[model samples]
Target: MQSNLSSADAVERIVGFFEHLSAADLVRIGELYSADARFKDPFNEVRGIPAIQGIFRHMFTALEQPRFVVTGRVVQGDQCFLTWDFLFAFRSYHRGVTQTVRGASHLVLDADGRITLHRDYWDAAEELYEKLPVVGGLMRWLKRRANQ
Candidate 1:
């Protein structure tokens, strides 16, 4: 199988991956990630597809409704940079409190046209922590103290 993938093809495949995520399409993930894929984010450092899928499954179960909306994307060679807004209502926490968190993911596709490494960049304090009730108040208090 040919390994090299055009930048456009890579982006399309990635967009598809997010769009069809709720379907739990493991087959699509298999096509997009290498067998030894590594995914890293602020809260997770998961290896392999099973582990990655497990995370998504947990997310699906935890959130009332979770979805990724791609706001922008830039592709160069084997790398694709995507900016997205994640919208979800936390069923476990503030019921009906829907939040939209902006984030970026950098994906590196291997020679086999599969993602070898995926790293997400985002600020938990701004995107998540500040939205919590007690924690948000504490974070605001700390910020005020630091500025003084």
Candidate 2:
């Protein structure tokens, strides 16, 4: 579990990894994250590579044709920001409904080129809650009311 890549290369590798994520890739999580890495998103805040891998594993099980499209990237020193669109078809909940969640990830790589911190920024109401059946209607109504 060693890499001779720079911080920028680490970011590139991460983006490329998610673009074609599969179950087998879970074993290689250590290649991308340090043993004590922290990963946080709107719904989950986890520490360690194993927990991070678990989140991704659940994603593959819950979604169909899931992929990440990196739209933009900015790297400076050991930190980088990546803009992306997560495209997926809902498996059980909204089966067959394709959805896209535009988001960004802020990653910090350690001296070893493994991620130490990974935080994702995205709107849950717009990306998920608003796409549900009953929740969608309520979310829309609440949005209109708030706008009024």
TM-scores of the candidates in the order shown: 0.89, 0.93
Candidate 2, pairs of clashing residues: none
True-structure RMSD, every candidate: 2.0, 2.2
| Candidate 2: residue 69 lDDT (0-100) | 94
Q: How close to the true structure is residue 114 of candidate 2, measured as C-alpha lDDT?
A: 86
Candidate 1 on 66-117: residue-level lDDT in tens? Answer: 8889989998888889999989997767888789889999998887678888
Error of 2 at 68 (Å): 0.7
Q: What residue runs in model 2 are displaced by over 4 Å at the alpha carbon?
A: 1-4
Residue 78 in model 2: lDDT: 89
TM-score winner: 2
| Lowest lDDT 10-residue stretch of candidate 2 | 1-10
Q: Candidate 1: where are CA atoms >4 Å away? A: 1-4
